[model samples]
Target: MHNEVRSVDGGSSLVQAQYIGTVNQQLPGPERVVPHETPRALRRLVGRNEQIEACLADQRVPLVVFDGLTGVGRRALARYVAEQVKDRYPGGAYYTDYATHTVDGESVISAALRSLLRRDGVRDEVMPAEPGLASLWRRRSSGAAAVLLLENVTESEQFLQLMPGGRDWLVLVAGRVESRLEVREVGGETIPVEPLDDEQAAELFRELSGLDADPDDPVVAEILGYCGGLPLALRNAATLVVVGRCPSLPELAARLRRSRAELMRSDRGPNKGNPVFEATYQEATEPAQRAYRLLGAYPAIDFTPPVFDLLIGLDEATSRDILAELVLLKVLQEEHGRYSMHPLVHDHAASLSGLDDEETHEALARVVRGFRNAAYYADAAMIGVERYRVADAPEIADPFSGDRRANGLAWFEENRRALHELLPVAEKIGLVDEIWQIAESLAAYYFDRKRQADSLSSLRHGIKAAEEAGNRAAEARLRSLASRPLTDLEQFEQAGDFVRRSIELADQDGHLVLRASVREFAGRYHDLTDQPELAQQRYRESIELNEAAGEARGEALSRMFLGQSLGDAEGLRELETAHRAFGELGDSRSAARALLITGQVRVRTGLPGGVDALTAAAEAFQTSGATFYEAQAREALHGALVVENPVEARSHLDRAIQLYRELGSPRAEKLASENDGGLDGAES
Candidate 1:
């Protein structure tokens, strides 16, 4: 079922609507285009063509300020020039308009950035602080020739927060003429946009009016003269004539003559801009206008037609048709079927909508539910049911279809970025179960990609959501999932807390399988924290529970972990059994981990088969794509082989160090520690 309730034509609370705007361009989503906030191409720029060409060619100054008195063509020139040079910037030429500037520096930067990230499908959360968010954006677009046109900026301080760290990045700031002094102080080239001369004014008037051989037309000349050679006023005057509301340019010129002083005053920009928009809007059909206002209520910068349907309570085809009309009217811009209205247009439409706070929240609530459903299906598909499985999960309409035709992993691969952005909304709306389920389900995908921080973040969100929902099982599972990353991070204190909480919850639940599953994490925490004896005991208890429940995977995991703590003869015995169990169960990764542990124990005991065991283990890790641990296993082999086959040992050392460096591990230090120390000397 399509997610909708209220029609764009009228009011219906969105909360009652079940909206799921899923499926779009390539899965994880297409790369973001820089916001060419104005028209993409301009044939002529009046007198500003030379200045625009100069700005386009300049390479030395990374920042350029287009300074002008308020009705001059500062914005038009910057946008025109950026489009000309956009191909040089593969990262994109996005705009950050500041005409709505309230003089709050922090809010200005945050709001603009929030807009861009949403355009990038980073919907859930962005970095909380200005510097951090700026740094994140710099990192995402690092080394790319990206351009940012900051329009109507009143203060240089506002630009500082959003400065891209890249030395070669282009920042074009358009503001009042006086702001040029500060802009110039910051290594920015200042281009002052003076009023257009008669020739330039005639060219602009001709372009706006689409007239041939008419630059010197007496009536057009008279009207253009009243515009004070300002492009905005000239364009506004021309648009009035083109829409056929006026009989002739001469009549409009006479009306402008009556209010000539008032219209040509310092505030002419607003007087020209607003009425042009209002007149254009007055001619739009009801559906297009309603779709315009309805979309203005959306918090995100860009959205697809499916989302538009959900928001406006219109069917997909009708919604898309209306969206096309708005795009035609230039109230919105559409690229590859996604729609984004200019900020100024959005603000105007939003003011006219008269939708109350309740309606806005209701609209957003539907979005949250839709997103929650997508996450739930994405979770199940990416991670499968065996790990941190949930029951009674509501499925969204599967736009991706069946498992064979669909790809669970690809969904996460493509959609994870969007999902991460939506998490904050989940928290805001209190989708408690959905939050934890989505988080816990992401473990397999996050871990496999070596995204430890993302895994830890999901777990943190899951823990809070589970606690809020009073879901003991979810809390236990989420905490267990958290322990692995904490251990990897060497954050022993937190890992210990996570395991202990998980164990307590499992014990209270009194489910043997759950307890067995969770105790493996307890054992892992003990091993990571260097409490080997305690680890062995926890593993034994877990093994006993798994054995009784006939859970072969659980038994094998507990035994493998126990072997690392036991060492020597007992270690060999436990590891051999675990390896056999894993192989029998067709779990290649688990079997490889067991073999690696076994190889370490064998080398310490001076076993003849140690080299062979370590070699096999390293190869398994390589096949399994566990690169870092494979390096460590190679280091262990090098330690054992150095006493005999020194050449092979040196070869192993080189490869291990390379893997360490690639994985960003302490390469030389880890190799030195393992090669010199080996495993423990017979562990008493």
Candidate 2:
């Protein structure tokens, strides 16, 4: 009487039914449990020679579960073993699909009773309504050995409930989800069915379709490799060979290659029962097919719900549901809250989405734009330098509002791999602006982490893209970003080369800001190489251009560097101007640097003492994670403290000397050592 079936959590089930019958009538035909269909000819198939021998061994629970990915022939092997073990069960064998059954935790007892009663040839007239179905099913199976074939089961709840209280019956459960099932005593056994080994695959291939020679033969191996160790693919590829459609082994390989190639071109195709993957896709519904195709729109392997919602035109819940279905079908995979499809399947999905070359480019462009925007917002927050900015910006609906840094960092980290792969494609498609924008956005993350190589590679590609696009302004800007990493790597000559090109490009394009910025880098290069005169000249030029262009911030930076070249006292003269300009731009770090510079000048001239100025500088540098500058300030502070007390002086001097030496700044280290020696001499 109780046949109303529903999912335990009110979620949609693949099948649902509500019963209205009150008599508890034992229906004869339709209500009986339907057995899983097994391929007929595979029952006594040759070449499971080892498995047949294994099943003949004495074991209490002689059941073996065959499990594999979609289209790998788990059912075929299971049926073959079932046929061989038929003589062991005196009461005959029963085949049923536990996968499609909706028997709840409470109803499993009844469902098992009905299934057992139907097999026991008991009529409804003698069966009682009460004492429950579990009691009735157990009584019917009394004093007999029963064998059951349970197919496509994913959960173990139903199986555990129906397992005969005694150990007389042998039960075999097969499905793709074996990870959830745990076996215990009463002669527990577990066997995982994997793709056939190459040799076994070859044997199955020859025995089933007459492709007999050594499979290790180069040509045969080539064909088997195309099958991807799946029995269904091998069977289909063999069928193609036997029918003279693709006769030679090489031709069959070609056919599979062609099939895969085509799978990548369209989203849907005839499941030819041969190419394994095509047949699997043929089994999906329209919604599942759409889900499969839409997954291709996500270029990164770890795609979140927000991205899927944005690009796939589906709501969060709907997308998750569809993705779940695809996961069950082996068309998609869910890992750590993100989704991914296999490369082969991804290509097919991309092809089938009806996107032309131009549209694909456009879609990729949108994704890149979103990524770049996130990167830009992160960079703008971290550093005040606005390397690149797009006009007519879209509104940002940030999900992780409380912590923008962590969220942006995570997004960049997740997509970093995919972004690297997409760079070449963007360049090939002539999206130069996009190329530079993405690089510029990631610059802060790379620079802050001291990933010199990554920064250089990104900027180099960005510069190349800009040059190819004939964008002189962008080229100049990219070259400036590129120079920092080159300098870090001590490729001074290359760094200087980029600075020169940026200057030329900026001047040619009349991009005054870029021209001013490039000149600042040139000045830095000159200073690093000990060409003070040349450094002063470049800094002066940058100052003049920045002033003329009304870029107060740029003007301030150039003048600050110029003052530093002149010496500590002179550097303080320009600090107030630099501070005012940086303040106007709301750049806390630059303003802080200017203040620190002013403090250093005061200390050098014995006005406020070097310790005070250096302490302020250190604090600013620490706040910004400016390790290099912070170390420099610490070194200066150590020098100032050298004269205060001998013990403290030696401690500061020794530490400063070591840090400078570790940084590979010989000039800085030599000065620190000189101070240390002077302190030692005085102390002695």
TM-scores of the candidates are 0.52, 0.57
Q: lDDT score of model 2?
A: 0.63
Compared with the true structure, what per-residue lDDT tens digits does model 1 show for residues 87-108? 7776677777764533555577
Best by TM-score: 2
Q: Which portions of model 2 show Cα errors greater than 4 Å?
A: 1-280, 290-299, 314-317, 330-337, 340-359, 384-411, 563-567, 575-585, 594-614, 617-684
Per-residue error at 573 for model 2, in Å?
3.4
Predicted structure with the largest lDDT when compared to the true one: 1
> Per-residue alpha-carbon lDDT of model 2 for 361-392, expressed as tens digits?
56566666666666666665555434333222
Global lDDT scores for all candidate models? 0.69, 0.63
For candidate 2, list the clashing residue pairs, or say none: 236-274, 267-352
Question: Which runs in model 1 stand beyond 4 Å of their true positions?
Answer: 1-268, 271-384, 388-410, 610-684
